[model samples]
Target: MTPRWTATGLSQDLPKGVVMAGHWQGHDLAVWRSATGRLQAWNDRCPHRGMRLSHGFVRGETLACIYHGWVYGAEGGCKHIPAHPALTPPATITVTAFACVEQDGVIWVAPADMAGSPPAVSGVQPLRSVSLTCDLAAVLAVEPALLGQDILRGTVQIDGQGHDVCLLVQNNPAGLTLHALCGVRANKVAASHWVENLRRRAEMKVAA
Candidate 1:
């Protein structure tokens, strides 16, 4: 089952004034950060002509659909329509918005009505994200020490020492994406190589 909050990506990956595609419980999301660093996640579809809002551009605090230049504000309400500059967009012309927040260097999204805060993941810093061709089961088969469905916690060997690692699992249509983090004092370079090796082993297992 999906949790109340789903880890989308790392905060550092989606910097200010940039938009990226994300997924949460099978919902495609257009996650973006404003010029001032405010985070937001909305339905990836544009209300105008079904164009993907993820293909849109971020201007200041608003997102503009690349298809027809339809501008949506922070509240997901249509602020301007290039075709009708003199007319105000109706409040009904709004994109679906989700509850989005940044915690522990990770970006999380859930239904707007979701309650409580995201799961706490302390003592680790953002590492790297890796997309594997295999599923979660293959990952566990390769490293059974890793546990949890949503957030996988385990100790991985890096540079001849055990280092705690956290893998925020995201089940994407193609496969799975692991938004990883490692202990603050761990060798990040070695940890990253370890992640790559794990991906290789898991994927090879699936192929076998």
Candidate 2:
């Protein structure tokens, strides 16, 4: 809530021309990437009829609401109204836009106005993202310092050895969501299962 950048997801999770539902600091967001690979985040509600924009589709550089077909450009301004082909929507008819950027394969957003870049992680290749039915504190308690902050570094035991792992935590309504990045030579299957195990442990901690 202090206007700091927070991780929404891993970049690879959102391919070109895709819109994903994201949450930051209690605000619901519609995070989309244009066909040209430009990333943009906006309030999930449409200016027209208050439609959920995350249910909308992406066409070229614009996001179109499924209900009214109101097309919004990267700047979040309405570019076209299907009901009125010749009329250009006023500037006031725009979705609330947010600051978005990609760093270290993570898509981060600033719900409020902010200038700095998102936290960066080095030497970690994004493996996957998983949601846990527990709070951030629960996950942090499981791994402590290794997975406690914005950027986490630790090791997961695989085949009797340790593999380096990095985790980016996102607070969501469902609880804590984690974007995992593993070392180059790490076994993905092992890393994935390790994440599931962590989730179970964290959730158990919450239940206990």
Candidate 3:
């Protein structure tokens, strides 16, 4: 029904040392890949002038603000300020960072420290990501068992065609974000077409 990166579509996204604008729940996120290929998530807003950190560049393990050039480490601590090169950045000059983990190529972000692990979707490789205008319930209404859970929670699916789909059911602040995956043997072209079809159908179903 839907594909959230935490479920399946993560590994296919930007690689290490890359930054992308992503959203979770309803919060704007600065999703970055560190030099070591580790994933980091931060509030997209830069502390200096409230610029979007996602638009910023990734230098080594840090993400630099595009506007004022404030550089932040993977832990979200301010490391350097371009305007005042000699001054040590105050420890307080840090963006609110989320705890992000990349396991089996899927990146997961938690607002606070997560006591337990994210939901399971092993044995599937990433395909791609998508967004929709539908909610989790709307998606589940169409395919209840798609979630594999008793409740209509967010779902992760391995399609009959062997493609892995990670459906992220977000609130309508900006609709939904879906991530799809496939087994190593899955056909990339077919998975892409299938995902696109699902995206259009899901968006239309909820929109109507």
Quick one: best TM-score, which candidate? Answer: 1
Candidate 2 lDDT (Cα, 0 to 1): 0.87
lDDT, candidate 3, 1-208, per-residue tens: 2323343227557777789887665668888887887678888899998999989999998899989888998688999988899999999988987767666666776666556676665655666777777765565666543563311223334345434444443343656666655556666777677668767766677778
| Tens digits of lDDT, candidate 1, 12-113 | 899899999999988899999999999999999999998999999999999999999999999999999999999999999999999999999999999999
TM match of model 3 to true structure: 0.80
Scored by lDDT, the top model is 1
Candidate 2 ranges with C-alpha deviation above 4 Å: 145-147
Candidate 3 segments whose C-alpha is farther than 4 A from its true place = 1-9, 141-145, 148-172, 183-185
Clashing pairs in 2: none
By the TM-score metric, which is better: model 1 or model 2? 1
For model 1, what is the alpha-carbon lDDT of residue 29?
A: 93
Q: Write the per-residue lDDT of candidate 2 for residues 157-196, one digit (tens) a residue.
A: 7656788888887888878688899988888888888889
Candidate 2 at residue 13, lDDT?
Answer: 92
